[model samples]
Target: MMSGLSRSCAVGLLAAATLLTATACGSGTADTSAAPGGGKPEVVAAFYPLQWLTEQVGGSDAQVTVLTAPGVEPHDLELGIPQVTEIKSAALTVYVKGVQPAVDDAVDPAKSFDAATAVTTIPAGEHAGEEHAAGEEEHAHEVSYDPHIWLDPSRLATVATKLGERLAAADPAHAQGYRDRAARTAAALGALDQEFAQGLSACRTKTLVTAHEAFGYLADRYRLKQVGITLDPETEPSPTRLSEVAKLARAEGVTTIFTESLVSPKVAEVLASQVGAKTAVLDPLESKPSGDYVSAMRDNLKTLQTALGCTA
Candidate 1:
């Protein structure tokens, strides 16, 4: 019933309002540098491992963006508007559900592969030092299950298979390439698993003392016992707790203290000094983009072998 002129004016106003709303939402200091669009399907990984696996499978067929930066701890990340926008626009998002709550909020569930659901998960801090493992789940703990699935090469190989299927589905033109790449990576991982099993067959000690509960999956995979200094990586241990850990380290005959690359080494240094032990780096492969997961994990295997005195 409205006049054409009036309809034209209404449409103009609606378009202008939409523009304003979009502009407001996307305004100011937004990271547009790695915004995902360049003909190839864009993939966004919640953390580094996903990014690496995607890169390996995607192989010039997809553009990948890793949300967590190198050397930063991913436990307490808050996604800004820029990252949220990136997630929404990405063609495929690969993430471990419950790892980063903010990333969960930003990604469309229907459009993502929640890798936590893709693989088996053990209780978080389940193998952490006895003092911290109370079979309790709290809001502050953030995630119920450990999100460090990538630490286990076999599990990562499994994920790579699933992810390859997803990638082939997304870009059918390069489907064979994705499958081929994934198979190669999966084979390499299988060999790594064999190596861990064989290499760890004759270790003098099987107990692992770690900076946090990050190594539970790796330890569990290789049949090693794990003890962690703290449940939360970012939290500073109270003086009392620190002393207790030192005492426990000595009592348990924990000879090698392991520190995470992302966290400070002070705690490990102090504990090692207390227990008359040496400190080593055991990367969790979460935020470290500079090091690929396989290579870092290989380095971790070497460190474990040396620290645990694995023979043959």
Candidate 2:
């Protein structure tokens, strides 16, 4: 019943309202907004370890949002639109390069902090000739360096210090707070590193057999040899590889085969039965543990000590 001109005007008004709504929401650019009235910088942590580290370094000065949820495997985390937008809007995104391909793709370089950059990285373990399951080839580690830097308390201490500086640079008003927290976090990690050094100093066996190659940093830090069943938990080890590892395990007197929470225990169980060794849970910490980082790591230390037959 309306005239053409009226209809045109109505369409124009609707378009204008839509545009205004979008403007109110936001754009692709970073948000950089302080949290409510607290003026805390918004930080995005890619996973559990980074989340804990960020919380320690940022303290009251930062509001951290963790991308990976507890008990979820972080290696194949798929980002939703909201998560991508969150990465864009956050003042800083803390992640280790090559851990999650989706996170690596989503983060803006200028607003992101790669934790691996803070420490000297070790070479990734070789998994040549290892056969993968269907649709699991994409999960293979593509980076030259292993991305599990958080396993080493000493290296993680370095990351905490650097993260504090980065946060200080981002939120200058809270620079002192950030620095203080960083120092405290670094000190805590340093103490943990000392504990590990002392506890692992007199182990009867130094061979650490794991389900996945997620503990290279830990092995490097403690001077232990890690024998991984596969490069990735999703990757199925070839029979040849399994037989080779089992032979090595028998020769080296490896009493325990380690499995993680995220990965299935069947592979480890089979390998253990083959080598006449027992299977134990050795958390890689790719996901959040029941306790906080420190507690979980302490638990890990205990597990390692027992498995290795450490005197201290």
Candidate 3:
């Protein structure tokens, strides 16, 4: 199996190819021809989750495309020339500000498009002040706020609302259509939130040991505890740290070791073997998924319910 970084790079290349092919076939929305009867606006999203959400809000009245593809890690994604061309051609663009810095770098801030909605994450204050400390680093590339904001149902609602409003402004002809879709999507998100609350409410264990700190928002929302994996999301963990985590899991009766989809499961597997626990893959929205936000959260909730042994 490829390491997490290699997998990310491979996925990025695949996305680049797909976008280029679409452009080459003349099937992309970049065509300058006005919409049929000049109806429905065109919107582009930086990644899959946002693309799904835009579709929900825009309904049949809008055309939406996600720059990233399934299984591709969004954090490490780079926009190819074709992808940049797509963004520049869209009527409106929706994206998470900190999650995909490459797209951010490619977009021009000075030019006024029909609309540009970037979801600003909850201040690190929401995460107990971890943001500033993480922000001080001077790297060659721009560091972003944890782009996992969509993991929280409430945050997803906020993002959808903002995107809906932007879409309405861009295409007044479809304002009602966008509004209706947003309402439905928000309601669906609320229902999903209740499922998580009810399903995980009575777990015998509240503390979750995971592959990274990606679960901070989920943990906070559900009032569960989190112990990070040996490695940060970006790098491998040291052997000593892995050993320590295994020891802690054994002592704490951590029945499930949570791994993510984009990362190699070796570290989690090793830890699980040492602790006599099972490993479960929890998605952190680092990659594109086959389904929309609600569907993804449902899968995640089912995994958490099983891992935590929730009674409901």
- C-alpha RMSD for every candidate: 6.3, 3.7, 11.4
In candidate 3, which residue ranges exceed 4 Å CA deviation? 1-39, 109-144, 230-232
Which is the leading candidate under TM-score? 2
In order, candidate lDDTs are 0.78, 0.87, 0.70
- Model 3 TM-score? 0.77
Q: Which stretches of candidate 2 lie over 4 Å from their true place?
A: 1-37, 132-141
Instruction: Assess the local accuracy of residue 69 in candidate 2 as a C-alpha lDDT between 0 and 100.
Output: 93
Instruction: Please report how far candidate 1 places residue 23 from its true position, in Å.
Output: 16
lDDT for each residue of candidate 1 in 1-312, tens digit (9 for 90 to 100): 999999999999999999877544432122222333445677889888888888988887787988987666786788988888777777678998767878877788766898777688888764333335432343343577888888888898998888898888877777898999989888988998988888888987888888887877888898988877777575555566667777877776778999977789998898788789999988888776456777777788898899989896
**Residue 68 in candidate 2 has what lDDT?**
98
For model 2, how does the per-residue alpha-carbon lDDT over 4-57 read when each residue is reduced to its tens digit? 999999999999999876654444343344343245567899999999999999
Per-prediction TM-score to the true structure, in the order listed: 0.82, 0.89, 0.77
Query: Would you list the rank order by lDDT, best first?
Result: 2, 1, 3
The pairs that clash in candidate 2 are none
* Candidate No. with top lDDT: 2
Of the two candidates 2 and 3, the one with more favorable lDDT, higher being better, is 2
